[model samples]
Target: MTTARGDSPADETGGLTRVLVADDQALVRAGFVALLDAQDDIEVVGEADNGEEAVRLTRQLIPDVVLMDIRMPILDGLGATRTIAGEPGLAGVRVVILTTFELDEYVFEALRSGATGFLVKHTEPADLLRAIRVVAAGDALLSPGVTRRLVAQFASHAKQPASGADLAELTDRERDVMTLVAEGLTNAEIAGRLYLSPATARTHVSRILLKLGARDRTQLVVIAYESGLVRPGWQ
Candidate 1:
């Protein structure tokens, strides 16, 4: 639930984003570092050749986001994700899983294992930068199929099936926000859809989190789909 400094408005900040790239291959790690360092607003803080080293670097640097590969030596990405996620006093950190194949089973396991977002190795620079920012801002970068599928699958498996769930008590408006959030709409998109200002949309999102006692959009997504506020395969 706690936020870090980089989440502030982009105008005042100058250093862009600081990131850590963790993968097993030396070539892959180098490529990621080069790509991120190319951006004026993004920086590669460090690189890890294995999952264990990733865990160590994460605790030491606490970058805005960790770009983790699914397969790695010394400890697979899922195990490292669990370690980073379970680490004491590092809840502010966000993990993004990296993969070459979208349908790879490890992608789903990475999510369940604790990644905040995910992307393919061939992701465009613009999208990759945006993903990092989304995670840094405490939002999950769920791009439809990749994120929604897992969300839907997880929701269907829950006991309550999500409808009529108390949400521990959020207002109807807050609940609406949660649904769109699960649908993976950004604040601007949500605002446009709801006919509200961007700032208003942001406020609604924040309030929804507070009301639901949820940490971020990812948790909100879990709540909405699980509670049947939003059923998967909906038109």
Candidate 2:
């Protein structure tokens, strides 16, 4: 069931970021809602006890971000993510996986399933706030070294790279930017390393995402490894 967070979906017309929290644990969900609701720039519009309701509320509320639990009844997080991703109407909605286990195998799958970020339940409140903003602003929450390690670990076992997953579609500079992205470097860091302007680096990333038909930077990282554009521990 979906619980309206007191604020109707229409209340999100302001600049405040609308967020939906989905978790099976009542206390945890309340904690997240309380923390997020306290933020001036954020608003918790709805809450769900499972992934199915999460997707339902997502479609109904059209929130900017969804904090989804990986383990849920009816539909798991990954399944929910895939469904949301498959819907063209939900393109603006970014799902961030919330897990107690940082390296859960499904975390990588969640990314491939169209989740743009992953966060452990123990993440600091400040970091959690930053993550929602970042993901909402069109960047992925894959900056954590654990994210890189997790992607690399599963990429090794990933089935043969998808057909046409090669980097031939990318220009030389785009390839460089993709490598830095796979290394967990942000736009600023990539610009610093590549000696390009931050805006230019961001442009390159956007182009990469478009040309490769990737959902976001997280998929670009997965492609870099799975397509052999980058290898594990190659730095």
Candidate 3:
């Protein structure tokens, strides 16, 4: 799990992280691999030219991060991400989508489909690496510019009542937790807001996730907004 530099998986796994590059373009995939591999701690475990292959390798390798390209020849990154995130065996295989168009609609769908985050294809190498590391640790990477735009888009287009009102199943404390989550507060921050311990906040978030059938905080945010619980100017 270490790189050729003798950096152990823990060093890179926490500091460096393992990555899987899935891009239809050979050159882009190769370039990403090279960039990631050059880092002292990172290890590139596998590559995929299409979504199906990406899903197959992800289950097999269980990489810490997947750099999934938005556009592809067969199944696109969104479909592949859905498949990967939906799979039970690769629970911690976070996906960071690679995009060509800035602020594209597919980007939002990718988030809904369970991508931990995304990066513009031309993103700075350091930023991309940091995103991989963040997502690998189970935190979401919400690019501010993209996040604002996406939130605005969701506000405008999240017209359909969510598929179901799983929220009705939540307790009062869970509702409060969901609101804070939708407002973009992390676990510790939510703990501070509610005057509860971090452990309590994490437990509430977990219960909300299970009860509401959400994939992650990103989806919870969507549910909060779409439900009209978290208003535009409230936070």
Candidate 4:
């Protein structure tokens, strides 16, 4: 079921991050809506009780981000994520999975399903807002801690070895940036380390994502490790 809510005036938010809260629990949905509504830069545009409704409202409202719960009645978050990801029109939309468990298997699957990131339910409200902004800005929510856990979980499941041609496509500077990105450095850190402006660092990252066909920074990290561009002990 989807909750119909009045659309907040755009001028009120000054180009706010329109969000759809998707969870099965009424209280949980209400809590998220209230928290987000309190922020001047974010607005709760709609609420969905299941994955199906989430996907439906997402197509209709075309929000900037979705705070999606992993467990839902009709369709799980992963399915909704995949559906959204597969739609070219939804490219500007990002999904952030909300879960109670930090290292659940679904976390990995959610990434593959096109989630920008996963946040544990107990995350601080400030961090939650920051994650939304990060994802909405076309960056993945892969903090160092999250990257460490993900690498530890998926290291053994590396895909087919990346060919030398994969490395050949990146320039030396781009490769350097890739390594730092793999190490979970944010654009700000990378900028400081490489003596580049933050905008330049972000441009390099965006190019890397495009050239490597990675969905986000998390996949970039996986490519770095699995491709032997960065080794397990390097970081």
Candidate 5:
């Protein structure tokens, strides 16, 4: 469902964003590869046709980002993401789930399983590129509206029970930042809303992540909801 558009010269390896794409459909995979390969800052390092192979290639390639489809043979994207996230050596690698629909049922589970975020298969080429760049730069792809809906819909059924003990670990300021983060505010936006400098806001987020032992901001969002620190339909 990816749309290929304009071409650009390749970037040198020194600063290139290495990526691996895993999808069952050949055409879809090809489209993603073509579009990414044309970007000056990105490079497609490997391709996998199944979840098992996706895990293998991801370990071998050590890609900065993995674009993984939710369904595949031998395993699923959620399983592979869990495997990758649990690996100590691959901690820096970010996984972005690819779904056929924006609100795919497994999207919330995928985020819980350690995905940085997700994108619909039909996402625009430029947006997809920006998502890759964002994830590669250590930011999650969560949009407030979609993420709130998707997580709220499925988080009530989450395997992990609600635990306010997690919230007890944060300072009041960190808690405020976490709430805004669950609302899908970026560091800059959070800074604006809280009347703090962007750097200070980022520090608060970092401290929250450390205190909660969250993998990243995406996981923090999950914690915020499932722990009842933030509730559904609350502005």
Candidate 6:
């Protein structure tokens, strides 16, 4: 993807989050660039018209976060996300998918492909900005309520049964943390429920991720469901 200059002034010196917007629609890209550029802590660094370009610009410009639209001309957002997430050099970069349908099938695939989270196109600007910041700060953006419904809707259709052996490496406390994580509890919520310090809860979550070889909280949720660590419609 070729880099297009943004309307806002550059603020790389201010420790701002650099962002790249990728969408097939010019209007959508322009609107996102304008909204994100207005923020004090965010700078719209570049824009791309397709997934292939998005991937190229990601490697070239190395922006902190990518606002990626799922459908595009050449390559799709899922393909681009896979490329970005698979590269060790681009590990610092994150992707938040843009989709029109809230429960689009591609959304699940996007998450599996390494996208941190997704937002429907009609999402409030404030929420959109928040999602960008959340992903950029190294956190996944799946809300608990939405995650539960999504997972419940899809989990039963999974071809493989949940596996107990996959979680053999985790200690009992780490398993508890993983269950809460799969339930979409933030570290603070997990800390409160388990009577642990937030820092301790965070550490537990980190250890769980490391042990499971998961990329982020979303993957942890997937594991919780797929490994039968947590199930739908059961307390």
lDDT per residue (tens digit) for residues 1-235 in model 6: 3565543333343788899999999988889999998999998888999999998888777888899999998999988988898898887788888999867667766766677778888999998888888888877444556766666667666665422336889999999988888778889989999999999999999888777767788777767876778888755
Go through the candidates in order and give each one's C-alpha lDDT: 0.74, 0.86, 0.76, 0.81, 0.84, 0.80
TM per candidate comes to 0.78, 0.92, 0.84, 0.85, 0.91, 0.89
Q: Using TM-score as the measure, which candidate wins?
A: 2
Best of the two (1, 4) by lDDT? 4
| N/CA/C clash count, model 3 | 2
Decide which is better by TM-score, 4 or 5: 5
In lDDT terms, which candidate is top? 2
- Which rank order by TM-score, best down to worst? 2, 5, 6, 4, 3, 1
User: How well is each residue in 127-229 modelled by candidate 2, as lDDT tens digits?
Assistant: 8999999988886444558888888889888755522455898999999999999998989999999999999999999999888888778888888888888
User: What does the lDDT come to for candidate 4?
Assistant: 0.81
Task: Report lDDT (Cα) of residue 61, candidate 4.
Answer: 81
Greater-TM-score candidate between 2 and 6:
2
Clashing pairs in 5: none
lDDT of 6: 0.80
Which pairs of residues collide in candidate 6? 1-53
Off by over 4 Å in 4: 6-13, 139-142, 158-168
Q: What lDDT tens digits, residue by residue, belong to model 1 across residues 66-167?
A: 999989888889899878876656677788899998756577666655578789999997888788887787654557556887777665665443223367
Backbone clashes for every candidate come to 3, 0, 2, 0, 0, 1
Clashing residue pairs in candidate 2 are none
TM-score head-to-head 1 vs 6, winner: 6
lDDT order of candidates, best first? Answer: 2, 5, 4, 6, 3, 1
lDDT of 2 at 21: 93
Clashing pairs in 1: 162-226, 162-227, 163-227
lDDT tens digits, residue span 1-235, model 4: 5874654323254688888999999998888888999998888889999999999888888888999999998899989998998798888788888999877777766776677788888888899889888888876454666755676576557454322237778999999999998888889999999999999999999999888777678667766776778776676
Indicate the TM-score of model 1.
0.78
What tens-digit string does per-residue lDDT give for candidate 5 at 1-235?
2221212213346788988899989999999999999998888888888888888877777888999999988888989998998898888999999998877768888888788888999998988998899989997445657877888888878887522336777889999999999998999999999999999999999999888877888888888888888888887
